[model samples]
Target: MRKGLFFLCLVLYAFSVTLTVFVQHIGIQDRLLKIVCTLGILLSFFAVLAMLFLAFSLKGGVESLEQKENPAEKIPSKEKYLEFAARSGLSRRETEIGWLVLNGLSNIQLAETLYISLATVKKHLTHIYEKTETSGRKEFAEKVMAFGF
Candidate 1:
């Protein structure tokens, strides 16, 4: 799915670049038509740039996950985990969620533990993942363990 989106963006980007050159030379006199064409080309290019950015970010995230995976790594203790989360600049809720997540808690368990709804748990997890620079739970857990170790 990602690859298909990327390829589509690439094709559109290339077409937009080619269109820009050709459209400028054709000398269309209709002001509205010219504006629309220019806008379309620019938007296509922007979409392509966005896709490229996401692709690279996802690639980095996948690499990070792979690098952090180690069964031998130990889980972090409470005080140490909180300290690390503080250093990592997570919010109070995010730190709590991160700690629970690091302890191998399921999402439902996290919600129950924190007295939050499942949606709220997911929301906090997203924030925690972003602040911790991790892509998902497994990577985040490994990272926390690695940090403590």
Candidate 2:
């Protein structure tokens, strides 16, 4: 897979180079050189990015293999994550709201689910986002997923 991805990137780079040269040789005057250069630069940049991606994927594979060889070296227990979340100033109510938010509930839906007023549900969500240092629902969801909750 890695080699296939590498070859794809190389082909893209070659195509970009060919396009650039073709434009220069064709002598078209209407900003064609600028367009070709832009394309070439973008292709080269993406080629480098693809290479970095391949390196990281290979490194991750190696690390997973090493972990299989020595599982005892893994980090602390799962409870440690919950403890960390608590220490990070997220209240139990906020955590509940986070879970509801992750479940695709709007403030009205959340209010109906929890038997609360819509205004109160919004208030709780505001507090939850504030405590979690998240600005929006998507970011809050990401944090919840990060905590594996």
Candidate 3:
């Protein structure tokens, strides 16, 4: 549908340009030719804009569908995540950071949420990584999920 809209817009612009050129060559009165060209330009502009809007909307729809198809990507329960973190020997702050990380929060967001500095967030994340035996957010999250708490 998006591709069809794009092609339709292209065809409309091409036809308008051809008509404008032909009208000029046929020696149409200046006023009529100007009006025709102006209308054609406006039509082409609107067509292109509509096509672009549809294309972007369609792309968003596809992304939404993909998310719906993958249920496992959703954030896990807080209790379950916290349980796994506790079992891993993480400190109180490290466990909190681990839960945020599992929920897909960035370091900046974690800092803001916990009212701590970015450096502090990083330090906690490092400790969480060490305790969980994982290198980064992705690995940590996978390991936490695999615990089946």
lDDT of 2 at 32: 60
1 against 3, candidate with superior TM-score: 3
- For residues 1-149, write the lDDT of model 1, one tens digit per residue: 77777777778777777776677789777788688678868868797787878799779989998997654346767877888899889998888788777666799998888788999999888888888899998888778878887
lDDT of prediction 3: 0.80
Of the candidates shown, which would achieve the greatest TM-score relative to the real structure? Answer: 3
- Output the worst ten-in-a-row residue range by lDDT, candidate 1: 68-77
Ranked by lDDT from best down, the candidates are 1, 3, 2
Best-to-worst order by TM-score is: 3, 1, 2
Each candidate structure's TM-score, on Cα atoms with residue i matched to residue i, is 0.49, 0.41, 0.54
Name the runs in model 1 displaced over 4 angstroms: 1-73
Q: For model 1, what is the C-alpha lDDT against the true structure?
A: 0.81
lDDT of 2 by residue, 29-87 (tens): 76867786778978878987897788789789889877764422222233643564586
- Candidate 2 deviant stretches above 4 angstroms: 1-85
What TM value does model 3 have? 0.54
- What range of 10 consecutive residues in model 3 has the weakest lDDT sum? 67-76
